[model samples]
Target: MDHDHTLFHRDDVVALRHDLALSLRAAAHHGLGEGICNHFSVMLGGNSGLFLINPHGLHWAEVGPDDIVLVDERGERVAGAHGVERTAMFIHAAVHKLAGKTCVLHTHMPHATALTVTPSGKLNTKLSQNAMRFHRRVAFDADYNGLAFDETEGERIAAALQGADVAFLANHGVVVCGESLAAAYDDLYYLERACQLEVLARSMGGGLAEVSDQVAEATAAQFARDRDQSRLFFEALRRELPLP
Candidate 1:
């Protein structure tokens, strides 16, 4: 374990790690993690060549800035003190390679996973903040073979995510990727919240009704405008995590 600081000292990786750790912990705290599985990563520099990811088998709530493993664009461990998670490298590595996204957050939460098990994979949007974010940023991947280990499966998942900021992995979970960790985490958090609400609404036997299109559009615009404020949420989560 070469725990060298030089590899992660770059402003880009540091900011990414800090923000990602925060988001990971938040996801775990909100019930998005399955013990030690699930993973998150963000690209380094401009090439998406050296991304930051968590070491395998670590609880999401227990991860910190120093716990990240730096992996090259092809999923090979490039730096840092620990090794990469096999599944994470296989899935996220392929995504950054083919999709060219900077931030990728994958998790398995209860409500969202339930939605994926169905054929429709539809999330009822009934005017709540949860529904508003799901208006258009979400995508549903109906096919689930198994854990992503090959480039082709990862590419297929990425294809399902095309034009979608947040995607539901059929019979598995959800994946959200964005330009930054804050943006990605914000989307992930809201997606889970929305799913939880939808589950609750459906259990009552009354089908949910969506807010008018005009209202939905307006609320989504407001969420877009408040993107800057999402930074504060991430910051607060950072303060609560197990810092290094």
Candidate 2:
């Protein structure tokens, strides 16, 4: 997995590293990341068979561009000062390879993980405008075998995605994927918000008001057309945070 560090210095690759690091910091800031567990990854440009991931042992709050580890599809460290976590390797590499996602974000954020443990085992997309944005874009994995200890487990999780951009892993966390980091991160943020609202609403003792499928689908499409907002939101994060 060792490679010339020179190749990692390409302008686009550097930018991706910065953006991924900033995203980790943002996730930490927003309480989307747990201790040193959840991982985020981005495929290296142009089908390079490599990706950047946060090194193990570093909290998301302190991750920086240089802390991002470059690894091959097999999860071997190609260039970095630290080692890759075992679950991160299996999960992220499989998602990038099997799901063909350019950006893969996995987190155990409180609200979303709370939904995963419920009987419904997935988000109720009809519950809120934020949830509506995820209508028809979510897949559910009802089986919770255990931790992803190997490649097959990772592949199973990827297969569960079933071409959807969001997946709620039974008894686990959630995975959010997108063609770009900004778009995926946007989904991650709002997804947690939606789930938080649902949890709060359920606590109020009244039946949840639901939106019709037709309305949810239309709302999703409307949100889809505002893709620029994702980019702008990420830009706003960069402006507000001390990322450099």
Candidate 3:
């Protein structure tokens, strides 16, 4: 059964489910996933009012697209035979509500999570590709206000993400949203890598060097030129896990 569309089709929903499962499993295999606390979602159909999110309390490796629950704009479960996470509803719902039908990935991956706890938490661009991809797309949340369980907190986060596509939830984790799951996953993957490198470099105690603004911008622009890069990255990651 197909749903109304403004930009995506039924196949797109299928593709999103497969990708989320693959991405989740890969994250689990790489020790990025933390039990069953994270959530990954992609917008389905053209209305920009609904999304597919992982079922609450399910491990990333076990989640399938078919297992993904469809949620409408108001955090209401609309499809699938599963329930959504409460925090996922508050956070992802608010994100989609403001960003419009977009894929949103939230996780408590190691390095990124570690960095979020620091007083001056930031995604230091010391790692080349990590630096390149994250350049200006990151938004840092300075306060860890516990689990997001209300529209107000969600709205605060949406406002924090004003012009960026990624956010580091202080004392919590990271959030990456995009026009597609491929793009969002690509960002989330590299974001963790970048955070890892930054933490490592800081441990060396010699400070870090940043790429010039011109160079960073040029690199990001080059990546943007290849719209298929996101999908390509996802495909490469799939080869590692190969299943949900």
Which pairs in model 2 have colliding backbones? none
Pitting candidate 1 against candidate 2, the one with the higher TM-score is 2
Candidate 1 yields a Cα-based lDDT of: 0.78
lDDT of each residue in 1-244, candidate 1, tens digit only: 3334476777866777777777777888887889888889888765536788988878988888878888776677767777777778777877787777888888887887888877768565544776786577777778888878777667777888777777788888888888878788878887778888888877899967777887887888888887886778777776776466
Name the candidate, 1 or 2, with the larger lDDT value: 2
TM-score ranking from best to worst? 2, 1, 3
Q: Which sections of candidate 3 miss by over 4 Å?
A: 1-10
- lDDT (CA) for every model shown? 0.78, 0.92, 0.76
- CA shift of 63, model 3, Å: 1.2
Candidate 3 CA-lDDT value: 0.76
Query: Over the stretch 1-244, how does candidate 2's per-residue lDDT look in tens digits?
Result: 3566776788888899989999999999999999999899999877778999999999999999989989999888888899989999889999999999999999999999999999998889998999999999999988888888889877987999989999999899999999999999999999999999999998899999999999999999999999999999999999988765
Which candidate has the top score in TM-score? 2
**Candidate closest to the true structure, highest lDDT:** 2
lDDT of 3 by residue, 1-244 (tens): 3444332236766777677778777778777888889788777665657777888878887876678777776767767767887888888877777866377888889898898888867686534666677777788877667778877767777778877888888888888888877787777777888788888888899967877888888887876788698888888888866763
